[model samples]
Target: MPVHNMHERVLSMGSEEAGALLDSLSAGTADRLWPYDNWPPMEFDRPLSAGAKGGHGPVRYTVAAYVPGVWIRFTFTGPRGFHGFHEYAVLPVDEERTVLRHTLSMRVSGLARLSWPLAYRWMHDALLEDSLDLAERPARQARWSPYVRLLRALVTRVH
Candidate 1:
């Protein structure tokens, strides 16, 4: 595990559902995740392991992560730096209800662990969780905004 990381139990929707949510969260930084953004999230591509479900089904993956200054390996085994390893476990809370457990883990080496505190700045989980319902369900009625063109400047590349 990395000297710094985050791990928390989040009540998820479903494997496929969560996968979609995961994809969307990732898309926010897709250009970065895929190494096409200004400050790309990682050094290389994050490869999804076979038999591990993801956008298609359950699965495991190893993603190279660059956390600001340090770089690390993330996988089911453990993360090696500031990046936290993640997992998706589907739990049957009920017949129609499933909880997607997304766990993030990081390895601690030396002084870094002593000084850095794990912080969840509304990352991966909360951000997606907020718009999850909106995304999962149908879109609301389209309302016209006169400043639609003006707002585009704020999110220059949202399209």
Candidate 2:
């Protein structure tokens, strides 16, 4: 299966602030950024660091690697067909700003081939964009497309 990727970056307020936001994610305290509040939130079995195991809803993964205030990677372990990882990173843009990036790169197989394109991809995109907005405070509302809204409605209800 080909690797599908979704990458999003936003101008963060500052390196300190962006690093802090990444810290919040590492602590599993950034649930508000997920697209729907009704769904199960992302979490780690232990703190977000190398070797921690966690995931939300049907997706499961282990923390493959991490660098405090810089990057954290989670390697997928579930939904039966996902083969890859997702990560968040903070790149210093300058003294007053940083680029907060979230990326998901995976090789899908079996059911994932269907689910990833038909369902998960759209939701993931919306979720990341919303997360990026939160990373840059005075958060702007995510402009959810009708497709994204529908996916959110269905997934949240089913879960």
Would you list the C-alpha lDDT of every candidate in the order shown? 0.34, 0.77
TM-score of each: 0.36, 0.88
TM-score of 1: 0.36
TM accuracy, model 2 = 0.88
lDDT of each residue in 84-116, candidate 2, tens digit only:
999888888888777777878889999889999
Candidate 2: count the clashes.
Answer: 0
lDDT of 1 at 63: 50
- Lowest lDDT block of 10, candidate 2: 26-35
lDDT of 1: 0.34
Against the true structure, whose TM-score is highest?
2
| Superposed Cα RMSD, model 2 | 2.1
Residues 1-159 of candidate 1: C-alpha lDDT, one tens digit per residue: 343223323333444444444343334444211211212132223333323222201122455342221122345322223334554344445444455444555544554364234322222333223232233344223232434333433335753
